[model samples]
Target: MTKSRPNILLIYTGGTIGMVKDFETGALKAFDFKNLLDRIPELKHLDCDIETFSFAEPIDSSNMNPKYWVEIAEIIESNYNLFDGFVVLHGSDTMSYTASALSFMLEHLAKPVVFTGSQLPIGDLRTDAKENLITSIHVASLQHFNEPVIKEVTLYFEYKLYRANRTTKINAEHFEAFASLNYPDLVTSGVHLKVNTDYLFKPNTKKRFKVNKNFDTNIALVKLYPGISEALLRAVFSTFGLKGVILESYGAGNCTTETWFLNILKEAILNGIQIINVTQCSGGSVLMGQYQSSELLLKLGIISGKDMTTEAAVCKLMYLLGQNVSSKVFKTIYETSLRGELT
Candidate 1:
């Protein structure tokens, strides 16, 4: 609401984008992102006012877990009112996971939280970090009628902005490192940045942002394979004291109709372990009951994941479990889309 400038927070959680070259050794090293203004001189030309905070000991995305997610959430929570928007510099490997976690952790958010990273070090001339970082900030600080646009968590890569949880890393060598097959790009870069206004979610600005930091990480993913046995199914289902399970079912959410396999899943559900049915395919949805192979799952009261990506489903389930909501409500809420991350 300030006329001077929108204060944007750049949270550097360590990634290729935050790396620089050690001239003597010519080795890539993580630099203090608090000196972001010194390295990215072009940032001064932007209209928005910016500030940064970096992890004390920068961690690669591979080491990311619930503990780190709590740190990021706490940072945002502590500074929620001070900044108009946020841009997270994170490793591409777990960016989707963190983004998905945040979408649920940060409830009723009315400001953009954009996550972007690069494949090459920022100090490299061939780096894509500059464009990704700059554009992500612009997208975060963007406003119309003095109201912030993109009031949700998103991942901007190449020239497309995707709902973070709905996306997955598709290629290693390509500049387009991520893709949201189940969802459309919220914005596309071109002669003029084209915003998908109709698809973009508009949060109720009156609602206060709430951070849900407590997450139960006791979750497991099981992928169905051909010739899989009852013993394997039973073992996978037996995650003692686990909070949730993401079952990566075959095409169209199809799983084996074998009695043992079905019984194992049925027992897990009965034991109060939340299980979500997601498809193994990258693009298609888990259309439960669409084929006979998956009919048993529907009959067993297993929750259909619909078109949710695995990343989204996992994070969502963790968030829901953390709240300790009743089983009935968890089922209802998990199937519902709060941040446009799922269908």
Candidate 2:
């Protein structure tokens, strides 16, 4: 049952948004969330009951990995019944990867899991942290007819809410740091919060909510370039325990039709290694057979990562590989959009 006032859980996984100035040392330090109201009194105005949880030690998003991703999944699983929604404070760097992993790991989501962070510390005079933090909680708290307005993993940044698996951190120096190229924003924040209901993911709430923690980190991401060589390909393919590869192919999923290159990929597949073809371009779908260069990939049965961000492809590969499914099942599911990740 939904509450009269949403009980929002704010999970701090560490980032600029959680930093504050140390008066004695003048160094940036993680702000204690126990004094959240004192730090950001703006939160008090939202019509919700807010609770806070912090990682035992802050992990920079650059240091985020599959184990930490599982830790996050466990936290949500343990608290799923108590909270209406969750807001994750993460470092902007690699935030999209973490978000995408969570989307796939958390099956049958029925509440909003809004991931957000800021470019500057919350204590800075001109910080963007306050707006990001307050609005994320408000977004998580939103309800209509006693049901959650958002029922998917999402990244709320700058002023837009995007499907987590579709997002990419596009800029480093700007306040607006993320973009969802192939997909549209689920919600926009301006004078008032505006939701694009048609774009929101409709989950199968009847299914039980659960978490998948066994992520395989034995995959590799290979970005193709104009002068990439056979030796380089051979070395990467030879890595021990390597189960899958996210091949960042050329525009429209094209790659050299050269026999040597194709042979290496062919050998990998024959040796029981899976390869997925994802576009290097940030804004297009990987239509495998659209061109002569990409046709071989179709014949080779390489998985097509249609319109999926590299971050999503990487995380999806990890999640699926961890499942220990047969190659046939893995390819079928990897090509399908389980979390609205690909168009």
Candidate 3:
């Protein structure tokens, strides 16, 4: 008897990785996915069947929005039975945001959905595209006893594989562009692939996979700075159609305890606006009640997005709002970890 090879789907949604430089003109142009195997001959060595799906009109990661997220989820849902795993080629600029959004959007995912892209174009002399693309495919194809080792949405960059929602793009010029500050990496690629099985997210095998396409984008992120004006704060809270706000407060979720500030926030909460307290610092969890400044926020129904990346908080708010979850239970659910995004 012969063993069957896994089938991996390669989704090209546009980015630096999909570009090739013209040798004579020195201009970059989109590379056709039809010639994928020819350009990267090493893919032929992988023990898996690969298929390609290119977006009709590729957009940069900056233009990435909830509609595109839904499109990606729909593609995976439509082909769930046909492919064993998926690799999404995206721009690194907003890759973390897209990855974070997808993590919540795809519930009960049991197969790998690996997102990867390079800082430099594929045709560049020092291009990181080939390695990132190849390694992501390998990571996506990984399985043990016919079950995938990584059964979640993950971002593969440089040599590290991080849970999608846990990652933040920390650099613009380096090949290593992302950092999973609060969570340990899932895998590290080297001479041999090393997977940290203990940190992997295990999905419920009994539940069926479903895609949630309804995302309410009526949200705002308010990053608190020293001497931030009351007018500015009021304007943000009063944004038309704003249903939720992710307040990037000072260290450990501290904010001005000034009476006016608290009143503004109190009014917002009273008007049914969900305010989530997330620390502006990169790596620490939000201990809302630890400081005097944050105590008022905690008492006034502010949800603590403990240690969750801002990207995850924004997407999670959009998802929860779309679910039309009752305002009474919103704070409890948002504070709790639903997709390993919060500690």
What lDDT would each prediction earn against the true structure?
0.87, 0.93, 0.93
Ranking by lDDT: 3, 2, 1
What's the candidate order when arranged by decreasing TM-score?
Answer: 3, 2, 1
TM-scores for candidates 1 onward, in order:
0.96, 0.98, 0.99
Model 2: which ten-residue window has the lowest total lDDT? 1-10
Write model 1 residue lDDT over 252-295, tens digit each, in one string: 89987888888888888889888899998998888878888788
Clashes of each: 0, 0, 0
Provide the clash count, candidate 2.
Answer: 0
What C-alpha lDDT, on a 0 to 100 scale, does residue 248 get in candidate 3? 97
lDDT of 2: 0.93
**Weakest 10 consecutive residues of candidate 1 by summed lDDT:** 232-241
lDDT of 2 by residue, 99-192 (tens): 9999999999999999999999999888889999999999999999988999999999989999999999999989999999999999999999
Best by TM-score: 3
Segments in model 1 whose C-alpha atoms lie over 4 Å from true places = none
